[model samples]
Target: MRSVGKQLDITIHRPEELSVPLRRAWHEAMDESPDYANPFLAPEFAAGIGRHRGGAQVAVLYEGREPVGFFPYERNSFGVGRAIGLGLSDCQALVHRPGVVWDMQELLRACGLSVLEFDHLVDEQKPFGRFVTGTFASPVVDLKDGAGAYADWLRSTYPGVAKTTLKKERRLGRDVGDVRFVFDERDPRMLHRLMEWKSAQYRRTGRMDRFSRPWIVDLVDHFFQVREEHFTGVLSVLYAGDRPVAAHFGPRSRTVFAAWFTTYDPELRYYSPGLMMHLHMAHAAGGHGVRLMDFGRGDKEYKDWLKTRELRVGEGFATRPHPVAAAHRLWRRPVRGLRNTVLAHPALREPADRLLKSVGTLRTSGRTGLERPAPRTR
Candidate 1:
């Protein structure tokens, strides 16, 4: 344990080593701060990631032996760290008691990280705000009265949007089968199908397939078994009669439902099944008491059409001096910049997207050929 000031002590522990009392305090702090109440920041999430990810650790901040703050991260051998579940977790912050203050740089040094990178940091993290390179709009649906109220509002506010979506849903039902939705599905088979469809979508779009990583695959598989009061693995699906057409897998807290991994069968793309899935999820989840549906940071037409409002999130590096940190930023920042550029401009984005699809075709086809090989040579 290291003392930051006369009043605070910071101790680092592996994720599994987080004590029960400490876990309770962490949740209490989350409940206290709307910024940190996301289920991704929950101790249960940290524990779940820790079970599969070896580098996972949490820094406990205590004031006179009472836990006051919790910062969870994944550290690599080179002392580079990232927000836990960085890529998938939309909300990132140090859960802390109100009025707790500490030096951010000192905290990084104590954790032995030369640089800490985050893409979806909560805007209230003022101590680290200066380090932000950019901020993005993270759209969300304010489900104040759940989905039913939202539907009524949608009809009144965006009648065209509501009408178009309803029309498409009806067509999907008529063309495929009666459209039915399951908000919190328990079947593991659906989970597998979700992963498979997501992987195919990644390849189809020339994006890196997250499911290709064994750790990620294992993590989702494990999450399927997790059921808790503060956090639960929610697998939602839209079915055409008995056949699944669209599916989403994400974790949810009691009040916040995160819109994480969502994918649908390519065959059903023409009917706009993905949009249908979100609509049903919003209604079902809100009815169950979820006050918000965070759509995460990204620019997508569908999100814009569905969102009630937008929240600010940040992307940047919080670093201490080290050659490794410098090198990492130098190598990584431009890639991020270029992607952001393309995403921001439709003139460039459309061509780039087409180019990526062409490349994806070649890549997947080549891999498929190698995997199948030609018939045995005579």
Candidate 2:
């Protein structure tokens, strides 16, 4: 690590050596941004994952003697690193000073990373310049003023869908027996239920079961149990006849609810319970002074229908300080090019999804005790 002049000191810390002061500085700097409120960027969450994942490196950017920013990432293989627990996280990147000047190439070299792939990176981090893989549009509902204003906006923008969702909610209340919605439900059992549903959904869709990982499951459980002023795990459940038909588990800040993981009973898919739950969540969040509902990354039909605005997240790779880094980049170029080409074509998207599914199936079948579970009916 190198220092710039006499103003800043740059250094890397092992996962165990991450300081509290550094974390505080990171939070303070990142919390200043309005459109940025991802709990994964917080120290506690990163530290927790780092403890489980191991080989995590914390890069502290200091101004004089005071810590100004922190970048927490994991060294996965051959000095390759990525945003900590990236696949499982809805938000990516570090809690850094917004306009801080830093060389991306230099930082990556310091951290000893090669091919830093990020799925949900902030749009403003233009370190990659023209090398951005592609942009992902995440849907969001503005709850800044209140839910009432959001509802008004939704009525004006997506009147038909909004009206249908509201009617479905009412119908659920009348027909489903005591329908209720809870935001920030502090129940570990409820979170477990949500995971179970999510796992089942993954298997049904021939996708990878994220919760199958012991560390990820434990991480989610730990977060669910943790309650704080700014960072807390929220489980929003839509109950019908005392049964949770739809559930969303995510992180929440004082004024933002980042929609992370969500799943609903397929039997109740006709009622569009997930969308109804989101509507309820929006109203409830507005009531609780939440200013935004971030739907996270993904191009889903529901997200398109529900969200009022979209935020873009970029992707790129960073190389480590090694001679092999160049060779690795050359090797990965074809793969990245193919991915970009497929993503560019609308018709190829479905085929790409199928190819991924086939690969997942092959991997699952080849592995022991990782077989996809048979569909369960509720």
Candidate 3:
């Protein structure tokens, strides 16, 4: 390990180079702070991403002989760095022991990064937090209530929809057979079905289907194989008798389950399977030792229904005053700003949504052999 400082020495290593003892220290640091409890911040998650992405590395911070912190990032050849897994990672932070502070500029210099870009940076990261141009609300559910919590919360918070949703579940169960939920489904076939459903949902909603990209597919497959104590790929499935109605694939830490991808069979849309999937997962996750389920940052009806609270997540480039950093910030900020503005206002958002759907329709019009589902019911 090469030292980058006198008092707070920093040593960089490829994700694979992180030893067993260093990993234990990293986990120990995470246990010291609730903000670092996210599975995305774990060494295992970094290792998973590193396996797929060549630039993944970890910078270990040392105070004398003991390790004090861990910083995981992806640095390109041009010295452009991003949070590990960037677009895919929901939580980003340099996990460190409490009261341990370091200069961002010095850290950047040590890692040979002119700027580090992050969208979902944990709020406790004051040094990086200051560089954030905007902060967004990442909704989360407190699972301390567990089991019967979803029904109770729904009845209390959304009385109108509560009866209707519960009624639909009953009707669905009767028509399709007994309803069941698998908190950690191990079926490989179900994984393929989930990808198909999610890809179709993405097209219908005019969102980019990540599965279309081979790297994302490979990365997800790699993550599916992870079974570390700190990071586990959980694929929860909702089934009615023999049919899979909905599925969600995400990584879970001991205390936090980071919601990643969820989609329902369009044929089962009338039953609100996607909503059911989340409610079921939230209820069951508590039994599996999860205290929180992070829904990530975004405005969604489901998030509104399920979130017990919101956490502030920052987005921006943490830099050390370099030309590349300036150029990168200038080039990226406006696009993000405009997108946020459009999403914030319903007047603009409605029109944008309509346009996107129209494009999606045109794009999917000529594609042959896609599964044709029965018409969706209200």
C-alpha displacement of 47 in model 1, angstroms? 1.7
lDDT of 3 by residue, 149-204 (tens): 56786576457678988898889999997888899998877877888788877777
Candidate 2 residue lDDT tens string, 1-378 = 477445556798875567666666766876888645666676766766776777777888777677776777877668766777777777776566666676777667666675566667878776655546677787888864444554575576458787777677667778777677777787667877888888867765667788777777877877786676567888899898888889998877777788888899888898898887777777787788788888877667778777889888876666545666677667766786787677667699788788767765655566545475432322
Any residue pairs clashing in model 2, and if so which?
A: 113-320
Model 2 score (lDDT)? 0.73
Clashes of 3: 0
Q: What is the C-alpha lDDT of each candidate?
A: 0.85, 0.73, 0.87
TM-score of 2: 0.85
Indicate whether candidate 1 or candidate 3 has the larger lDDT. 3
Q: How many clashes would you count in candidate 1?
A: 0
Question: Relative to the unseen true structure, what is the C-alpha lDDT of residue 161 in candidate 1, on a scale of 0 to 100?
Answer: 78
Q: Highest lDDT: which candidate? A: 3
Selected candidate, larger TM-score, 2 vs 3: 3
Give the clashing pairs for model 1.
none
